[model samples]
Target: MSEANECLFCKIIAGEIPSNTVYEDDSTIAFSDIHPKAKVHVLIVPKKHYANVAELAEQDSHELSHMVGIAKSIADKEFHGAYRLIFNTGEDAGQSVFHVHAHVLTGEVMAE
Candidate 1:
């Protein structure tokens, strides 16, 4: 996937599209999910885009760690120590956006 040309999350990170930003650093940006699956649902994406975890792992695994750290930090503050970090790698896995992201799902209760 050409992230700059087509990825929605890339646009969100670039400020090409607005997002409810929660956390940001040089490497990543964390924001509230527009269609939240949980009370504290958020998505953490890297400024440098990769199509998915495998692509990211092959290209630059450090970016993956950066994204995970951001997710953990967000969960720490928002979930008060409980959350799930999810990565849907492909369409079959429910990854609608090709750009890699970590979905932080939290709150008192979440759907299964």
Candidate 2:
């Protein structure tokens, strides 16, 4: 497994930082976003650190599927089975944190 020394998501996974965790397993965690862009916004991340989807693909493709599975489960319960799963790969794509995470958005129509 890979890890970063200064990654915020790493801290959260380590329990060094507090988060409103919704779901968790040995390999991944899902939590509510602090600054939500939609009514229901959750962040699903892997315990192992990866900078982005491309990095994650290089490291472990299974983890990507696992993260998405968790997101689908969350959406099924919270938003009655309707949601958007997003991955912002770079700053220009709106990715802020370096760690790879899936944004599960629902409960409102997002601007196009």
The pairs that clash in candidate 2 are: none
lDDT of 2 by residue, 74-106 (tens): 878877878899999999999999899999998
Q: Top TM-score: which candidate number?
A: 2
The sequence of per-residue lDDT tens digits that candidate 1 reaches over residues 55-81 is 988998888888777777777887786
Global CA lDDT computed for model 1: 0.84
Model 1 earns a TM-score of 0.89
Candidate 2 yields a Cα-based lDDT of: 0.89
Candidate 2, residue 11: CA error in Å?
A: 0.8
User: For candidate 1, which ten residues in a row score worst on lDDT?
Assistant: 1-10
* TM-score of candidate 2 on Cα atoms, chains taken together: 0.90
